[model samples]
Target: MNYKLLGKSGLAVSELCLGTMTFGNTTNEADAIEMIDRFVDRGGNFLDTADVYVSGRSEEIVGKAIKKRRSDIVLATKVRMTTSSNINGVGLSRKHILDGVEASLKRLQTDYIDLYQVHVWDHATPIEETLRTLDDLVTSGKVRYIGCSNFFAWQLMKSLAYSDASRYVRFVSIQPQYSLVSRQMDREMLSLCLEEKVGIIPWAPLGGGFLTGRYTRDEPKEGRMTTKVGESAWINRASDQNFSILDAVVEAAKELDKTPAQIALRWLIQREGITSPIFGASKLEQFEDNMGALGWEMPTEIWNRLNSASALQDDYPNRFIEKFRRPFE
Candidate 1:
């Protein structure tokens, strides 16, 4: 497995990070352990979880799975997703940040988190308060690095500028939903991260299994995309545009003799500024299939074909600026 430096940090992480969101949920303890073992055996050292996943059972399962090799793993988790009903139980306030980390550390059975991220933006709290609290976590050695997730371009920049001016630890990475069907990140977040040097760790890299090619246009598939028995699911992702992207992935997979999921994941792995893609699986076989995304490069022609199929349309100022970009170029 090839590793990349996470943003400007010296720490190196695997290209594909094992996501534990399904752990202790659809994935049983035995299956979760098997998947974790196989991932580590295959040279994967990065794992991601969160306090809010399965109401904290996911973190407990992950902690038990990696306790023996804890030192060798780059474990990451998040906060600010309403872990409790208390008035001060959530958000990025200094009180919540401190309380959240203490609980996360205890559940993960680790002294320090490799990377602690805010799960989402909290507009109620001041950005300064959150940045300072995260800096204090780094100062106290409770967190090795800080990151933000699901933040808009302006929110992220505001936090970074505050960190720089206040001389606090800045966010080194971002976790956003990015995949063949979900190119929304490309609209603005992608370029912002590239210019700011923040590593992009894409979550739902397979479009929540839409790009896996298991679900059909008419027939529902047996996967996470399902809502209930005999229930059509992921209707929002069933647009004609996404079908075209899926067909493109299938064509590339056929030529490469790989699965659609692997090709789709490889597309993200090859994108600029992407540090890693957090992939999850309920069964060991699924884990094995996704791990195949590594150890090879996609052919340029096929890569471009998939890229063209999933290209995002420029809007407003982007279209306006592109007309004048040639002068600067």
Candidate 2:
């Protein structure tokens, strides 16, 4: 139930954010409402949804669920995905951002968004155009902060540089897919966020349920891995290395008498520079299990064990640069 300042901003948010991507989809409206209630009862006040989630149904459900305590919640949502048949319905162009924010505000039943993020990089639009539009949102009181998701290190740096030079509102947070099984961020994005002072609210902090100890190496279950066929496909994430990391998590769970899901989440919560890890559930039980990730600290030995199991191999400039470091006298 601890709070942290989001990036370098004065805004304080809970260490764990409730993700509503499954609301009105796998989870019905009633269950979603209950989950939000429990989350708030447990001292959580951050909620994340995207306009594109379930064709905006998720936003609608979240809007209804939090109507009573709107002032106490930090709401975040994203744009930049195809929302309609119109040719100008997508991307970070000024047209789309302006249109998207208006639509998001209506669906969320809120006058302003706590954080409005571009879901991904829009190469078609000039960075300046996107930055200016986001700046306008802040200026107009429609958005309090801006952020980006699924961006490369260079893309984020480019946006930050543009914001600094143009005197625009800089991105204060980033939402990346990070977990024990997905350490790709460790390669570059991690260092970039650490240096830039940007908060990281990691999506899929449990590797789309991979680190939840629900799946086996040889048998894929009836969850996203078996049903969805995208970047999170079983073929893509069921590699030997990832299984080893899962094994470590399972071992830690057994030793500590906690679920593998909690172990995996605690690992991310303890990682330096992680602001909050967004977790969602289709059932109330799943949400309750994830809540176990809080209330206790993971022992250093278990944390190190998971870290070593999932550490990515050093490559190129990182390895080469490490050899030249000199000890301070």
Candidate 3:
């Protein structure tokens, strides 16, 4: 139920953002409504979705559910993902940027989106074109703030530099897949956000169910992952290093009287410069389980224990720099 500022913006978003990716795809319309109610009941005001999710059904479902209290929930959606076949149907071109907002706004049943994000980097388009189009949106009162998702360090830096010089709308947040099993963001993206004062809204805070502890080394189950059947499901494609950490997550959760999901969420919840995490669930009970991640803090020893278990090996420049780091000279 805690809240944090969305980057440099004055808006205060809930610490846990209820992600709608699972709303229309995994659950039926009735169940999606129930999940939305449960999230609102839990004091969550931030809701994140995208135009491309579930082929745009996600937005329709969430837009219908939020009909009663439109102002209460902070709605966020994204563009830059293909929504149609027309030449102007995708990417961050000025035409697509403006057209995408119009379509997303109509689908969400809202006059203005609280935050509109670029879903992916459109290397084909100029950063200036995207930022200028977004700035126009802000000026027109169609979007409150702007953000980017799945952007690399250099891409984000370049965009920011362009915005800084042009005085266009700047990105207030970055959404990336950050979790116990994935420390890839820790290298450059994390530090860049830290230094630039951008909010990190981590997606897949549970590592796509890898840290849920149900799919253990011994008792792997059928319905643990996002898939319905089969072994080589994308969920089971995790590296050996990831599963090895799951064992430690279970042990620590046992000692702390918590679920691995809670500890996984708590780790990011406690990490510095994280604004909010976008969490989703296929069922109502699962939604309740995700909410349990709040209302408690993990002990320090257990924190370090989980950290030691899931650490990734240093790569390239990181390894080289660490090898010659100077204490005093």
For lDDT, the strongest prediction is 2
Native-vs-model 1 lDDT?
Answer: 0.90
Weakest lDDT window of 10 consecutive positions for candidate 3: 228-237
Badly placed stretches (over 4 Å) of model 2 are none
lDDT of all predictions, in order shown? 0.90, 0.93, 0.86
Model 2 whole-model lDDT (C-alpha atoms) = 0.93
TM-score of each: 0.96, 0.98, 0.93
Greater lDDT among 2 and 3 belongs to 2
In model 3, residue pairs whose N, Cα or C atoms come closer than 3 Å (at least 3 residues apart or on different chains), thus clashing, are none
Rank list by TM-score: 2, 1, 3
Give the poorly placed runs of model 3, Cα more than 4 Å off. 217-221, 224-236, 319-329
Candidate 3, after superposition: displacement of residue 228 in Å? 12
Q: For candidate 3, lDDT tens digit of each residue in 11-70?
A: 999999989887677788899888888788888999999999999999999999998899
For model 1 the local lDDT of residue 187 reads 81
**Residue range 220-293, candidate 1, lDDT tens digits:** 65666666422125666778999999999998899999999999999999988899999999887888899989
